[model samples]
Structures are given as structure tokens and as C-alpha cells.
Target: MADDDDLLGELLRFKLEAAGHDVTIVEDGQSALQAARSGKHDLMVLDSMMPVLSGPQVLRALTEEGSALPVVMLTARKGQDDVLDALSAGARDYLTKPFIPDELVARVNTILKNEGNRVASADH
Candidate 1:
């Protein structure tokens, strides 16, 4: 997870860890991109507005590198265009700022569940 805000990062880290997913918190986009490239994580929760590379930039890089890891973009910009832009850039989901933690968790769970089904089916 990459969030410039320390509190938000910590909260998300705790929530995810409690859900049995190991979480890594980074304050900037550069480290997040580096970590993503290492392919060490099952998914990435990115703040759309961040220092160094920005969420859209990171998403574009991941897409170009063929990293299929699911990404959920969090942003204060709730405009329809903004959401569409994130989706077009390969974000699996988008959440506006000040969102409920439960909503975030539910969305993450849904995405992971779908992904798990896809992988299991493919293995058959």
C-alpha cells in the first residue's frame, strides 16, 4: 500500500494484516513502484495523488510491464471522468477519499475472491 498520509497507511496496514494479508506501507510512489515490480504483493492499494510517480503513472507502468496484480485507486477526486481515467489506466477499482474502511475491505475481498476463482479455474 502506498499512501502519503501516515495515519491512513497505518490504518490500512493494520486492517489488511488483520485480514491475514501481509501489508507493506510506503509513503511515496517510487518505493511502491519498485516493490510492485518485485511482484511481492498480491494486490496494491494506491493513492491517486502521491509524490514521485502518482497512481496513474504507476498503473501505466505496471500495465506496460504486464503486471496483472490488481490495483485499487483511492482519490479525493470523485468526478466521473476521474474514475473513468483510473479505470482506463488499469485500476481494478476506485474509492473516493473519506471512505469507510469496511467498504474498502469489502471491495478488496470481492476482487480477491474473483481472482482466486479465476486462478483456480485456470489450474483445472
Candidate 2:
């Protein structure tokens, strides 16, 4: 996860780790991009309004590099353009800030499960 907010990051890390998911928290988009280059994660939860390159900017770079790593965008901006910008830049999912932690967990689980299914089907 890439979030500028320390409290939210800690909360998410604690919850996700508790739920049997290994979590890595980065404080900014640059670190996020660098970490993702390792192709180690199954999914990324990105905060849109981050320092040193926004979430959409990172997504755009990833897309340009042909990295189809699934990304979920989190932001305080509820505007349609904000959400659309992230999606257009290659976010697989979007969430508005002040969101429920349980909901984020559910979304992450669902996305991972669906991705697993897709990979399984593709190997047939």
C-alpha cells in the first residue's frame, strides 16, 4: 500500500496483516513505483494525492511500461473526474477516502480471488 497518511497506513497494515495478508506500506508514490518494479505483489492500494508523483501518475507509468499489475486507487476526491482519471490511468479499482476498513478488506479479497480464478482458468 502507498499512502501518505501514517495512521491510515498503520491501520491498513495491521488489519491486512491480521487477516493473513502480507502487507508492505510505502509513504510515497516513488517508493511505490520502485517496489512494484520487483513484480512481487498481487495487488496495490494507492493513495491518489501522494507526494513525489501521484497515484495516477504512477499508474500511468506502469501502464506505459506494460505492467498490468492490478491497482486500487484511494482518494479524498469523490469527483467523477478524479475517479475517472485514475481509471483511465490504469487503476483496476477506486475508493474514496474516509472509507470503512472492512470494505477495503472485502475489495482486496474479492480482487485477489478473482485474479486467482483468472490465472487458473488461463492455465487450462
Candidate 3:
């Protein structure tokens, strides 16, 4: 997760880890982009308002580099245009701030399940 707020990131990290996922928390987009490029994570949850590169910028960079890693963007921007911009920038899903943790977890699980299914089908 790329979030400048340590508390929020820690909360998310705890949740993901408790659910049996290895979580890495980065305070800025630069580190997040580096970690993503290293191909070490199965998925990424990014905060759109982070410093250094910003979420959309990181997403664009990843896409331009041909990385297929799925990214979920979190932002306080709830406007339609902001959400559309995130999707256009290659976010697999977008979540606004103050969202329910359970909802976020459910979305993450759904994305992972769907991705797993795709890989399984592709191998057939």
C-alpha cells in the first residue's frame, strides 16, 4: 500500500496480513513504483494523493512499462471525473476515502479471485 498516512497504512496492513496476505507499506509513490516494478507483489493498493509520483502517475508508468500487476487506487476524490481519470490511468478498481474496511477487503478478494480464475483458464 502507498499511503503517506502511517496510521491508515498500518490499519490496512494489519487487515491484509490477518487475512493471510503479505503486505508492504510504502510512504510514497516512488517506493511503491519501485516495489511494483520489482515484481514482488501480487497486487497493489495505492493512495491517489501521495507525494513524489502520485497514484495516477505511478499507474501510468507501470502501464507504459508493460507491467500487468493489478492496482487498486484509493482517493478522497469522489467526483466522476476523478474516478474516470483513475480508471483511464489503469487502476483495476477505485475506492474513495472513508470507505468501509470490509468493503475494501471484499473488493480486493473479488479482484484476486477473478484474476486467479483468468490465469487458471489461460493455462487450460
Error of 3 at 47 (Å): 0.5
RMSD of 3: 0.9
Worst 10 residues of 3 by lDDT: 12-21
Per-residue lDDT tens digits for candidate 1, residues 1-124, read 9899999988887888787788988878898899898878889999988999998889999999888999999888898998998898899999999999878988988999999999999999
TM-score per candidate, chains pooled: 0.95, 0.96, 0.96
Please give the RMSD to the true structure for each candidate, in Å. 0.9, 0.9, 0.9
User: For model 2, what is the alpha-carbon lDDT of residue 85?
Assistant: 82
- Candidate 1 Cα deviation (angstroms), residue 25: 0.6
Candidate 1 TM-score, C-alpha based = 0.95
Tens digits of lDDT, candidate 2, 15-111:
8887789999998999999978889999999988899988888899899999978899988989999888888888888999889998999899899
Task: Give every collision pair in model 3.
Answer: none
lDDT of each: 0.90, 0.91, 0.90
Per-prediction count of colliding residue pairs?
A: 0, 0, 0
* TM-score, cand. 3: 0.96
Question: By lDDT, highest first, what's the ranking?
Answer: 2, 3, 1
